[model samples]
Target: MFSPTGEIVADAQRRGVGVGAFNVITVEHAEAIVTGAEAAGVAVILQISENAVRFHDGRLAPIAAAARCVAELSSVPVGLHLDHVESDELFDQAAANGFGSAMYDASKRDYEGNVAATAAAAQRGHAQGLWIESELGEVGGKDGAHAPGVRTDPGEAAAYVAATGVDALAVAVGSSHAMTTRDARLDHALIEQLREATPVPLVLHGSSGVGDDDLRKAVAAGIVKINIGTALNIAFTGAIRRELAVQTSVDPRRYLRPARDEMAATVTRALRVVTLL
Candidate 1:
């Protein structure tokens, strides 16, 4: 029963360091995350997204509750997070489900609109004793635009946090969502500038696209939370695909066990890179 209580993020912020926030799509993913974190001796965040919730028939409570259960059972500190959420309704649902933190993404809207919506979401999240994370620039591949080159304005980001009162801010610095490759190049100077400009901790979204060395550099430059989704998915799915292709008549657990182990190793690699351990 080791919930994070924002200790990881707070510690990172206080020391100008970083923590990893990986998205959990299934029980296997949850198990892998906790396993990896304990092995590395570092705290981590387990996040569930809105699209993932939709896939489970609009019921966030069960999955969120499951994530909380995973967090509680882990040996290392964990925080259950809702990733890239857009609606006030779902935001409320996350708090009720016992999420410790969440990211409210309104980057598709105009800057002012994003501020208003994120601020409202923050207000609701804070009321429930939950932490709020908001994004600045839109991560590409969601609306089919694929604007991976967009960078968040340091000045605008500072203003956005002041307006929204978010605990963390995800800013664009050359990472795109759902990337299958780790070729993304981050703006290290921009990250340092943002750290100076904003009061809250900086989160790097679409971090699966970032290579290991660059990820460590980003963290050293003041990124406190790194959000990873596609990398673990790739590991999980690839392991399963490889296993299923080899044996058609095997039990599901036999395949899923390796899948979970592979994903846990992937998470361990990621934590090592970003946490610099």
Candidate 2:
């Protein structure tokens, strides 16, 4: 059965486990994510971001459809989500195009505006039977906007979740977005505090920068969803590069298949680390 985002994520939280949110850049990525999840017998989230939609000419249907198809066929639970969507139109597009969940990122907006917009988006998403996740405090590392010093306040997080009625909250603890290295450290104390403050499951964005030991501790501290992108993308692209380098005249499938297989191996390993499997 296809479990809703809130249900699967909440269950994972209760079990002291974390679910992987893998960014789907192509149909191949989606396939690898779902395939790994089914093999592991764990629920997974397939995410498409605003940038991904733009890559497809503002239409999210193709990727969204592919994710939904994977979700439907997978033996394990899978949820299609829109990640870091900054516009109402993109949010609406994700909802309309078959995404079961979405994260409305207004983190760049002023605090009050972020609250209002995210709250409105939460209402809109819930009305469509979609789960909504919102971020607080910016995840740094994109163009150097975030540093290890960034953190979210427990009081503010509680208020944001209350005001927005979101299904989950993505809080900045210490990870930065788009980090090519794995030196980021999480604030385990902050994780415990935020977990105590908020009723909803907490999400950790920019997780690719977090080390495996730190990721396990974060989940142990109560983070239910961990979003990893850059790490897996690097693994996938590296495999493609390796295959193409050895056989320059090979078809795309010849290269892409190895990429997908390598990515699935990475996903499976990370899932074990994050979920304590």
Candidate 3:
């Protein structure tokens, strides 16, 4: 059944588990996430990023429709999220496009500018009955929170949430995006500190780099929503590459099936850490 992002997140919070929010680049990605969710018997989020909208030719309606259908058809609970949204127009499309929640990314702006922009975005989201999430500047390696030595302050995070009225905050402790290696160290004490200091649920971006043991520890420390992208991409792309190297047929279906299955397996394993661990 389709679930509310807030409900899933709140439930995860109450249970001391991290809710996995998997990024959906294609409908296949959404399908695989749901399959993994069902296998784990957990409610998972399917996230469509602003870049993904552009990749679908600057129209969110089609991708949104497909992802929504995938979520609606899932046997397990699933929620749709618009992730890393930088444009106000895109944020405006969240509710209209069937997204239950959105992450307004104004972290590239100056601190005050981020606050102002994110605050306005949060207001719009709240008025539309959408759960809104925001980050405190860059957190790690890529665009969606990854830079060396940059970490969110507990005081500033609390203030940002208060200033923006966002439902959740993505803070950097130690993790980089697009990391193939799963050895990124995390600051569990800082996570606990932030959890204590901030009123809303805590989110962790660029978590693909975090190892399984560390991921479990982070959730235990107080991370509610964990964003994972690179890991799924790795599984999907690697499977496709291997299939193409051996197969004579050029049909996309033949390759994509294995690719999607590989991603599903990766998702199930990752979900187990946050859920069953």
- For residues 50-161, what per-residue lDDT tens digits would candidate 1 score against the true structure? 9889888988988888889988988888988998888678988877788888888898899889998989889988898888898898667555534544678889988888
lDDT of 1 at 249: 62
* Model 3 misplaced stretches (Cα beyond 4 Å): 143-149
lDDT score at residue 144, model 2, on the 0-100 scale = 71
How well does model 1 score by local distance difference test?
0.85
Candidate 1, position 144, lDDT: 54
Instruction: Compose the digit string of candidate 2's lDDT tens values, residues 150-230.
Output: 578899999999998998999989998888889898999999999999999999999988999999999999899999899
- Worst window of 10 by summed lDDT in candidate 3: 140-149
User: Could you tell me the lDDT of residue 170 within candidate 2?
Assistant: 95
User: Which prediction has the highest lDDT against the true structure?
Assistant: 3
- Show where candidate 1 strays beyond 4 Å: 144-149
lDDT of each: 0.85, 0.88, 0.90
Those runs of model 2 whose alpha carbons end farther than 4 Å from true positions after fitting are none
TM-score of 2: 0.97
